[model samples]
Target chain A: MEDRFEVSILLDFYGTLLTDKQIDIMNMYFNEDLSLGEIAEINETSRQAIHDSIKRCYKQLKNHEDKLKLKEKYLNKKTEKENLMKELSKVESIDNDLLEYIDKKLELIINI
Target chain B: MEDRFEVSILLDFYGTLLTDKQIDIMNMYFNEDLSLGEIAEINETSRQAIHDSIKRCYKQLKNHEDKLKLKEKYLNKKTEKENLMKELSKVESIDNDLLEYIDKKLELIINI
Candidate 1:
């Protein structure tokens, strides 16, 4: 479950690097959790073809992740932020203003 | 000056997406601050060819930046961290541990 979510996150980051068709297929397969047969039927193609496309798109996305490691960086940043927030929780009552600022900044990071 | 630095930052993020030759040429030209003639001499190619390669690599890097925006994400993260640090400075005496943790995390992000 988490692995598929990771793939979807990669698709969000690097989807534009792929072709429009590839992006659509990935969204259907990964995000929509559609079977290859369903995607093939919708695109009027063979299931084999959809399978091949998904495989290729997955390879491409993985290559991007390997080369750039943007996903890894993102995960690291998220962890760091979480740790910082946790540490801040230890000092909550004493520094309410700083606590509020960090909270808002975390939200900003999520949206960005 | 900042523009070239920005390009170098983009290269750091997307340089691996390029071919080995393209990455080498970009590093020489952008990071080493080499002229086309200098890179041409090192690569044993004509200056015009080197220029063309640099232009193409630049376009490729820009396209990657446009698509993934890892640089923009990094900058935004930096700004957010800086702002948080600034806010923390106001409450330095109150929460030393959180301030120290954030300082370490910012350095970690930069290295990552």
Candidate 2:
């Protein structure tokens, strides 16, 4: 379960850097939860080739994250923004429209 | 002037990945406005070496930015946050405390 979530986050961060074939295999295995043989059948490749491509894709994603740490920075910013939103909500006499506007800004930060 | 600002932005984005000597040369050349000969004298290297290192550093920074684009993404988010802040301030009956809190959150996003 933890590994699944990690792959999802990795895909979010570095998926664009991967080759199209790698992405297709990853989407099949992780997103679709297909077996290695299933992906091989879909792509008309050997199961070993499908497995190897997925492994290579994972390593590339990890390497990119290791070099950049963009995902770590993004997660930190997201946590900080959420905490700020909580504090802003607690401020006395804050208006609903103002709160909504602030919420929108925070959503932008987290989504980025 | 435009080139100076570009270097500053580039430095901000990829300064971490540069070698210590490269960073020193960049700081002296761009931030301190030191000439190549002056930087060479300070670093005890040839003026040509200083020039070469600065050029290499700039290329490395540009390549990093091309691959990741974190700086570009940051600037876009900052612009969006500023616009949201402007809209937030225009909302009716927003208290000073709420406005200040929202401003703080926006600052956090921009600074990130």
Candidate 3:
């Protein structure tokens, strides 16, 4: 399940970078939770065709993830930033200067 | 971008649910860095058809993500598990009984 999320990240990236039909199919299955039969009906294609496309897409997305490793790095940075934000939020009191500094840092992190 | 990773996760999930053609286009674009013209040439389709399919796919994927929120929860749990693992790994030494317990817990997390 955890790995699935990682895979999801890869897929989303792939969708954006790839062709429209790929994105459409991805959205239909993942977003709509449609069965292969249902998707085929909608797309006017066969279930086997849909299944093959999905499997191939998964492989390609995973391959990209393995090569780039961008998703892992991004997740790590996001986790760190979230933790820092939590810490900052828990602080009961802060000097005005420190508060300003933290706010600035947070803004930058959030923007990223 | 940070948001892009989250989107990627959604796309990957969508791809799994979609048709074979969808997956093929996704792999061609995201994994192979193929342009729309190239993709159309390979698929023996019109560029406009590819464009429409991709745009529609993005919209549908985002819609699913917005409604389901599964990706967000998964990411949070994963981040927490990773932190716990890090803490456990940092311990200098452990008593036999405690080590057994920690190891058990770590094993469960890794399996998840």
Which candidate leads the pack in lDDT? 1
Chain A of model 3, TM-score against the native? 0.71
lDDT of 2 by residue, A1-112 (tens): 2277778888987787777888888987898899999999999989999888888888888877786676787787888877877886776666566677677767876576
Model 3: interface root-mean-square deviation in Å = 13.0
lDDT of each: 0.80, 0.79, 0.59
> What does candidate 3's lDDT look like per residue over A8-98, in tens digits?
6776554655467876776677766778899889899999998888777777777656644446645665565555445545445434555
Candidate 1 C-alpha lDDT tens digits along A4-105: 888898897788899999999888888888988899999999999998988888889898889888778778867877776777777645567667776777
Shift in Å, residue B57, candidate 1: 0.8
Candidate 2 wrong stretches, greater than 4 Å = A40-52, B42-44
Query: TM-scores for chain A, candidates in order?
Result: 0.86, 0.87, 0.71
Candidate 3, superposed: residue stretches over 4 Å from native: A1-7, A90-92, A95-112, B1-112
In order, the candidates keep a fraction of the true contacts of 0.62, 0.30, 0.00
**How well does model 2 score by local distance difference test?**
0.79
Candidate 3, after superposition: displacement of residue B51 in Å?
A: 34
Q: After superposition, how far is residue A98 of candidate 3 from its true place, in Å?
A: 10
DockQ of each: 0.55, 0.42, 0.03
Ranking by TM-score: 1, 2, 3
Give the higher-lDDT candidate: 1 or 2: 1
